[model samples]
Target: MGPELHYQMIISRTAELRTEAADHRRVRQVEAAKKERSEGGLRRSLFGKFSAA
Candidate 1:
């Protein structure tokens, strides 16, 4: 509607983008950590079974 309103909208959008990016990054970090833990557990279990055999 006005110049000030347009500027405010732009700033609001930038903030939303930053917040979304941070959330995405956190989700990825958590997923990667879980994957690493799962792989580590599998490796240990397999190693134990092989060693016993």
Candidate 2:
């Protein structure tokens, strides 16, 4: 293969890998936010019940 073609292929592959990594990071951030919210709700509910006593 020509050097120019090889260089282009390398650049394209790098871009694809970067996009995939960003997507994975975004998904993890969303999941973490959901988990934090759920845990916070659970804590509030538990304390609310105890505080009533």
Candidate 3:
């Protein structure tokens, strides 16, 4: 293959890799937020019951 074509291919591949990495990072952040929210809710519920009783 020619140098120009090879360069273009490399650039396209790099862009794809970067996009995949960003998507993975965003998904991880969402999962972490969900976990934190659930844990927080559990803590609040426990405390609320004890206080009410």
Candidate 4:
């Protein structure tokens, strides 16, 4: 393949890989936040029960 064609291919592939990585990172952050919220809620509930008793 011509050098220009090869260069273009590499650039496009790199861009696609970066996009995929960013999406994965966003998903992981969202999952972590959700887990933290759920754990926090559970802690609050347990604390409330203990305090009540």
Candidate 5:
């Protein structure tokens, strides 16, 4: 019973760590996409102003 309980605890802890790492990766991907979009918008605005002038 003691060894079985310890094994279960290790499994659960490993699963939690996996989930946290996946979440961190997903967040970084989302932030990178957003930064790219904003930069693209800035470039378009600048080009539009030059064209208008």
Candidate 6:
């Protein structure tokens, strides 16, 4: 292949990889937030029960 075509292909591949990485990172952040919220709710419920008693 020609140098110009190779360069274009490389640039396109790099952009695709960057987008994939960003999407993966966003998914991880969402999962972490959901886990934290659930844990926080559990803690509050446990405390509430003890405090009421």
Task: Give a tens-digit lDDT track for model 3, residues 1-53.
Answer: 99999999999999999999999999999999999999999999999999999
In order, what lDDT does every prediction score?
1.00, 1.00, 1.00, 1.00, 0.99, 1.00
Q: What does candidate 1's lDDT look like per residue over 1-53, in tens digits?
A: 99999999999999999999999999999999999999999999999999999
Q: Give the TM-score (vs. native) of candidate 4.
A: 0.86
RMSD of each: 1.7, 1.0, 1.1, 1.1, 2.1, 1.0
Q: State the local distance difference test value for candidate 5.
A: 0.99
Best by TM-score: 6
Off by over 4 Å in 1: 48-53
Candidate 5 to truth, TM: 0.71
Return the lDDT, model 3, position 16. Answer: 100
TM-score of each: 0.77, 0.88, 0.86, 0.86, 0.71, 0.88
In model 3, state the lDDT of residue 3.
100
- List model 2 lDDT by residue over 1-53, tens digit each: 99999999999999999999999999999999999999999999999999998
Instruction: Give lDDT for model 1.
Output: 1.00
Q: Cα lDDT for residue 41, model 3?
A: 100
What lDDT does candidate 1 reach at residue 48? 100
In order of listing, the candidates' clash counts read: 0, 0, 0, 0, 0, 0
| Candidate 2 wrongly placed segments (more than 4 Å) | none
Q: What is the lDDT of residue 28 in candidate 6?
A: 100
Candidate 2 lDDT (Cα, 0 to 1): 1.00
Q: Write the per-residue lDDT of candidate 6 for residues 1-36, one digit (tens) a residue.
A: 999999999999999999999999999999999999
Higher-TM-score candidate among 2 and 6?
Answer: 6
